[model samples]
Target: MRTGRPRQFDRDEAVRQAMHLFWENGYDATSLSQLKAAIGRGITAPSFYAAFGSKEKLYKETVACYLHSHGRVTDALWDDTLPPRQAIETTLLRSARMQCETGHPKGCMVALGVMSANSEEHRHLLAPLDTARARTREGFIRCVKRGVENGELHAGASPDTLGLVFNSFLFGISTLARDGVPLSIIETSVRQIMALWETFSVKNGNELPNG
Candidate 1:
């Protein structure tokens, strides 16, 4: 008698489930068993390996999915048509709202996922996350540079310093969300954060404080 074909599973759905698992629990904390369970539908170890290649590979795919889905809001940062201030504000607001949403994991996958790498191999596995973060920082730098060029910000303002500050604040919002801070509070804080940009405005005629 001919054997039945192996059961088929939805690869996209599996990646989303795995993304939620990784988003809820950091890379080192999530296990193969947990991953299989999260994928469900009786996905066996061999089947899992055949489908995803390996745990690290699966995590990479999951991160990509998370970026494409929940993380796409920040793409406004790269929109040259928007004013620099608007681009930064849009990124901050979108990120804050996304992080605080109740449906998904509380914090940003990029911010919380793979924070601590136990080994060189693990670091390599998490390299994409690092790249994601670097890209955000670079976007901030570009926006700040554009602000200077457009005279929205003072010529003496430092893009590197401003980028670091903005990226750090963005990352901190993820931590606050994970800590159970309310969405309303995060949104309010976003407004306050945007006010800092005003202090850098060329219209305000403010200069960086001397050391």
Candidate 2:
């Protein structure tokens, strides 16, 4: 006989497992039984129901898990060391890389979910998705403001306009990737987008580190 694995499942771990499941397959495709199996916690349906209330609640928890884990992009982009435009480029490239990388599921959960408008719950899900986008754009605005203060970005550039333009472009890229755009095309497109932003940055004026 051999020693067994850890006895109890951590709630966070379970939620992470659920996040992967939901990320791989949308809410409508993933069943409660399937979630039980995917989590590998030997969880009973009644237990899951009692704890999470319903699949909808479980999905909300999964979104929370996704946000908490991936929100680092916003944090990193807002770092003061990088020029605002370059920071936006870095975040977009990283996000594009994630969409093309193996092991993890491709595409954004929000964009993928928004593709269909079949149900009220599905439509409701777009709210948090939009909120995430808004939060990301806000981060960009803050970064641009910091860049302006330090003269790392163009002084005349409107932060609001730049934020909307960059955010809209990023959302479009995510939508394309979510819709199964080819990896090569995604890479090339993202690189071009980054290059465009790089041209407008104050890096050439000796404002940012290493450009």
Residue pairs clashing, model 2: none
Q: Write the per-residue lDDT of candidate 1 for residues 1-211, one digit (tens) a residue.
A: 9854575778988998888888898788899999988785667888899889999899889888888889776798899999988998899889989998877788898888547456676888777788888999999999999998988887888999988888898999988998889888988887888787788887887775553
| Whole-model lDDT values for every prediction | 0.85, 0.69
lDDT of 2 by residue, 1-211 (tens): 8854433567777788887778778777788898877665567776676657888888889887777765355565667687666677787777776765665566666556554234775768657766887788887777667666777666765677667776777667656776788767876776776664445467675333332
What's model 1's lDDT at 72?
A: 78
RMSD of each: 1.9, 6.3
For model 1, the local distance difference test gives: 0.85
Residue pairs clashing in model 1 are none
* Regions more than 4 Å wrong, model 2: 1-11, 41-43, 113-118, 121-127, 147-149, 179-185, 198-211
